[model samples]
Structures are given as structure tokens and as C-alpha cells.
Target: MVKKTDVLVIGAGPAGIISALTAKRYYPDKNILVMKDVKNGCIPCGIPYMFWSLKNPDDNKLGMDSLKKNNIDVILGKAVTVDRENKIVAASDGEEYKYEKLILAFGSNPIKPPIAGIDKAGIYPILKDMDYLKTVIGELKDAKNVLVLGGGFIGVEFADEFSKISGLNVYLAEILPRLLGNSFDEEFSVLAEEKLKEQGVQVLTNNKVTEFLGEKKVQGVRFDSGEEIKIDGAILGIGAVPNTDIASNAKLGIGKGKGIWVDEYMRTSDPDIFAVGDCAEKKDFYTRRRASVMLASTATAEARIAGANLYRLKVVRENKGTIAIYSTYVDGLVLGSAGLTEQSAKKEGFEIISSASETIDKHPGSLPGSNKIQVKLIFSKHSGILMGGQVVGGISAGEVINIIGMAIQQRVSMSELETLQMATHPYLTSAPTMYPIVIAAQNAAAKV
Candidate 1:
């Protein structure tokens, strides 16, 4: 039997949901269906918060009420295969869906280290399914010693959250010399590590997990240098693997980075097929090189573009590139970064001109609850254009990186930033005379 729909979106992640909703908004009468492998998948970004911020697992649930309110059908099943020629998708439950346009928002999977004993009962990888999350929560509730593998955002966030539980021993390990080495500059990395340490998290750098030693469940992990650290459980947050097997089976062109290759319009090799989210390849905004960024924010933006242009290409958003903007908060301190780090910039063969400024987030430095703010700007010494930026400060750090991202996207010259106007208040932000962006730009101006 043949099922019909105007657009079929597989995977009800942020990208999938946004695509379906956008399609429904644009084509009100069109049929829209979303297939999610997990019946109850929590929002990926909110999963780490289950440790401290959220009292219960249900707090992280991504309610489907918005989708239901929009008249979109959500199927609770995994898609088995796609018949591109027939324009149909077959679910594992013998159900079939036919669509005029197919959007594969199937997100990525976490990369589980193939270490011995990883399959033990106490090892947990970052997963979207809420069932596993509940299991993890139960296990961790009684876990006194928890080891977090990796120092990326996920690992750091997990460590920060788990460390909050009274009496729980939390350690965040990384092979690199700095935490968030891939995104933030050294100063910001140092500051972040300091904050993580202050939050009762044991920060370990230049270390790697060698083996998981346990009989029934993880008891401890062996370091590469033959030392061992006892732990009740382990959270592997190294990286992720994109979900592209179905696309591969359907002969979709995959990029060298192992993500599905799509054009500016998000169209895969097959004109009728499109890929977005963590499974899709993206270009670097500054370097024009293939980038492997998998932020939910990036995915949703891509979904918006893909959904709006799926029917007749109404929007003209080219996947011009990804800035890889990233942000995370811990114990009320927010850290944000955009584009490349100083190390990455140098590695990419660019002569970097960098500047940083540290001042109070609020004016007068005496405002109640005021905290110090640090901003770093990196630019090409020759071109004098903003290549990257990092901010460690106030509650606004979460959104402040957008300015840096925009600067990188627009290739804003350092000279143009000196005269830029930014609003500020004595209670809310730094004085206009001490604006971080302009201040950092001015510092760069001296050397450039």
C-alpha cells in the first residue's frame, strides 16, 4: 500500500521539527509526517541539564504539542529504508510513507570508545532516548565516583552538572592540554577550567582513558600512563558519529568528513533527497574548507533554509559556511566562542593578530553580583579581519557570541569594529567606553 504526504521528515530532532513546521507554515494544505526512532527523545542540548538543573527526567522532554497543534503527524518508529526512485520510505513496522519531498534530519550518534569493558553496566554514552537517560539517572544517583571522558562542551557540561550533587566525585579528563581547545582561546580555556575546578569538578588534562576495568560494571578506568582512577561510572563524551547509513544505502553522496554531502540548497545527490542536521556536511565560513560542526543551533538554521526552499526555493540561504559558534554555562558563569581558536588559526596557516581584555561585566565594578568579563579577538595580521573570538563572562555570553559569528561571516575588518556602537547599562552591561568588542578591536589595532 502506498502512503502519501507532501513532505516526509525522518528524525524529529530540532532540525526535523523545524523543517516540518516550516513546511506546514508555508504550505498549509500539504501533508507532513515526522518519524522518530525513539518514541520519547529528549532535546539533545537539554540532556546534560538532567543532572542538576532539572529535578526529573521528564523536565527535559521535548513535548510534541507544538507539532500536534500544527496538524503534523509524528510516527514512533525507525525508518528501515528509503526507495528514492519510488519516493517512498519503509518503516520497520511494515508501514510505508510516500512523499513528494523527503528530508533526512536523522541526527548523529555518539561515538563510543571501543575500549575493553565499555559494555559494562556502568558505562554511559550521551544518547537521546529518555529510557536510557532514566536508567543513567538512577545509576548515577547512587554513584559516588563518576568519571567524565573528554573536555568538550558535552563532557564539560556533564561534569559540571554531575559535580553539583553533594558528595559525588566528578572528574573531567582530556588528552589535550586545555579544555574546549578546539573552540576557545587559551585564556578562555584556562578560565573555563578554573570555573570547572571551582564547581567541585576534578579537571584532568593531558590524559586519556586507556581501559575500562570491571567485571559486571565499570569500577574504574586505567590511564595511558599505567595509573588507575577508581570510579563508580563513566560518561563517554568524546565525539559523535553521523547517522548516514540509510542515506548511504540509497546511494546518496557522502562527504569525506563522513557526513552526507549537500549543495547550497541542502539537496543531496538525488534531487528529491535532502539532508540536514549533524548528518550533513558544512563548509567553513572563513577558510572555505569542509567543517565538521554538529551544533543543534546550526542544524535548526539549516532546517529553516531547507524547509522554506524545499518546494520552490523561496529562501536564498546558501550553506555559505558554518561559524561553529559554541556556548555553555556552569555555576552562573557563561563561556562562549566562535570560529577558530588561536591554535586552529595558526594551524590553518594564518598569521594571527590577537588581543584580549578583562574588565567587569557591569560598569563601576561595584554593581551587586557583578563578575569579571574577559573577551579575546583573533584576526589575520595581514587582512585584519575578525577570524575568531572568545568570551568568558556574564549571563549574556550565551548570545554575545553572535556578534563574533556575524563578524566572521561578514569578514568584518578590525578597522570597522573600532567605531562600532554597542549599548550598555551600569547594571546590565559594561560601559560603552569599555565595550569588549571595541576594546579588543582597539588592542588589535595597535599591532595590526
Candidate 2:
């Protein structure tokens, strides 16, 4: 049957929810509907915290109140296929939706390792599903020893959360030379690993999970280094696979990196169909290469573009390409990064000059809760343009690197950051004289 809406959004997480709300606001007279695969979705970013940090799994439940208030329809069903020519979406429940324009905000799924015994009863992969999470949590509660199968942020966060149990044993394993190798430099990555170590979590890098032992449930893990660790449960957080099966099945162009290819306005090959969130392939702001950077921040940006330009010509205010900018806390230290790392810049064949500064977050240094802050800025030696940056220490580290991300996005040069204006206070920020970004840029300028 033909049911129609002015705009239809898929997925109800950050991207889908934002797109539905924005579309309704932009075109208030138009009917908008958001189809959610998850009957009740948890906050995407807050899923890790729910393992132990939250008292109840439902604590992270996203309310449909906003959609109802905005007069946008929210449909609870999985999108099974999209027909661009016909402008219809076939949901798994056999409900069909017809749309004048559609926004694809379906997110990603965890990429399970090819290692044997991955299907064992005690093995679990992190997906944003609530029922799956509840089952995993129930199993973890009875597990005395847990083997975390990746050293990425999700893996570490899971390991740390699981470690909250008094007698729970947690071990983190990574195949990279260092944990968070793709996100931060060795120094920052090493510091994060060190903190996890102090948290009573085993840190193993430069190792591969070769096998999982036991007939039904995971009893132990074997590493390529000939090391075996006994455990009752295993959680895999290695990486994500974009949920682009519908896109691929529909014959939309997929990128070399395996995500649905999208342009500046989040438009897929078939302009009638747009893809967003972790399911969409993002381009690097600087290099224009396919970017593997996946974050809710990036997803929201794409949603804005898709919502605004769904039926109209592209909007110029926002470029869909994003610099990889993100921050996460490990143990008590906050670590953040934007653009490329020093090593990445060198490997990318750019002549790079870098500088760093170490200082306390507070000017007086006597503040009760003051934390030390370290800032490093990398730049093109020839042009003095900011290429990337890394910052650790203090809670503000979460947002500080975003300042660098913006700089990189706008291609701001060292000269711009050196003269950057920032609000400062002993209680809220670093002293004016030692503002982290400006000071870090100053040091990089000196080297250049």
C-alpha cells in the first residue's frame, strides 16, 4: 500500500533522531516519520557506561517524547530495503513507507573476528541492542574472569566497567603495537595503557587472538605469541561494520572502505536516497580520502546536511567531510585528538614539525582539583598550517581537541591559533599566558 510522508528517516539514534526533528522543524507543514529498528534504543555513546556505570540498562533509553512533541512519526521496525526509483522503504515487519525524500541514518554493527570459537556461548559482540546487552550483562555478572578481545576505547571501557566487580578479572588484548594506535600517538596511547594497568586490568598489545577454547562457552583465549589466558567470558570490541547491507543490496555505490558512499550533502549515488551515521562513508577533510572516523559527532553533522537538503539543492553552510575529532576518558585521564597524528603525517609524506608543552590545568597550581595538561600540535613545517593535535590531562581535554579539530577543518594556520582568543579563569580554564592550544601552537611555530 502507498503511505506517504514528506520526509522519512531511518534509525533513531543520534543521526536519525536529529534528522527527523530537524526535518520537521525545517518544513513544519510536511509529514515526517522516523523508523527505528530498535524498539527502544539506548544512547549510542552511553551504552558502554550502562555495563556498570548505570544502575539500570533502561537508564540510557532514548525517549520518544521529543519526536512526539515535534509532530514527527516514529516507527519501530527495521528497514529491510530501499527502492530509490519508487521512493519506498520496505521494513522487515512488512510495513512499507513511501517518502518524498528519505534520510538514511542507520548506524553500524560490531565486526566480529574470524577467530574460531567466536560463536561460543560466552562470546559476545557489542551491538547497541538493549536485549542483547541485558543478556551480555547477565552473563558477565556470573563470569569470574573476562577476556576483553580488543584494546580500543570500547574494549577498554568494557573491561574497565567489568572490572568494577570485586573478584572479576579482565584482560585487554590488541593486535596493534599500542592501544588506540589509530587515534593517538604512542606517548598518549602508552599513557592510557599505563592507566588501565593501574586499574587492575591486564593490557596486552602486539598480540592477536588466535583461538578461543572450550566446546560451548568460552573458557580461555590463546594468543599468537603462544600465550593463553583463562576466562569465562569474552567481549569483542575490535571495530565496527557499517550497517549498509540495505544500501549495498539496493545497488547504491559502496566506497573502497566498505561504507555507503556519500557526497557533501550526505547524498548517496541515488540522490533520492541519502546515507548517514556510521553506515555512511566519510571523507577526510584534509586529504579527501575515505575516512574511517566514526563518531556520533560526525553522524549529527551529516544528519543536518541530509535534513536540510533532502528535497532541495545542497546547502553551503556545512561541508559533509569531517576531520577525525574525538575524545575519551581512560581511567581518570582524558585523552583527545584531531586531524592526523605526527606519525601519520610523516607517513603521509608531509614535512612535519611538531611541538608540545606541559603545564597544570590551573594557573595557581594550588587548586584542589587541578590536573596536569599536556598539549602537542603538529604542523606542516613549510606552511605552518595545523595538521593535527593531541591533548591529555584535566577533564576539559574532552573539548579542547575539538578546538584543534575546527582549526584543522578550516585549515587554520599556526598564525591563526597563535593569535587565537580564549576565555580563561583559574577555576574554569588554563591561565591566559599558558592557554593550551595557543601555547602549543606557539611552540610549533617556533619549530617551524
Report every candidate's CA lDDT. Answer: 0.88, 0.84
lDDT (tens digit, per residue) of candidate 2 on 1-448? 7678878888888888887877776778889998887766778788888878898998988788999998888878888988888899998878788988888887988888689888899898877878878888887887888988788777878777776778888898899878888878899988988888888988888889999999887899999988888999988888898888888998999998788998887889988888888999988776788888789988888888778777775557456477778888876789998888999888878898898988888878788888999989999898888889999997978778888888887788999999998888888778888898888888887775
Reference-based TM-score, model 2: 0.97
- lDDT (10s digit) by residue, model 1, range 1-448: 8789889999999999998898898788889999888878898999999877898889899878889999999989889899988999999989999999999998999998778788988899888989889988888888889999999989989988987899999989899999988887777788779988988899989998888988898999998888898999989999997899999999999998899998888889988888999998887877767898999999998898788778777546667788899899877889999987888989999899999877887888898978878888999899898989998887866666888888888899999998987788998887788888889999999986
**When superposed on Cα atoms, how far off is each prediction in RMSD?**
1.3, 1.3
Candidate 1 structure lDDT: 0.88
What ranges in model 2 sit over 4 Å off? none
* Count of steric clashes across candidates, in order: 0, 0
Residue 42 lDDT (model 2): 76
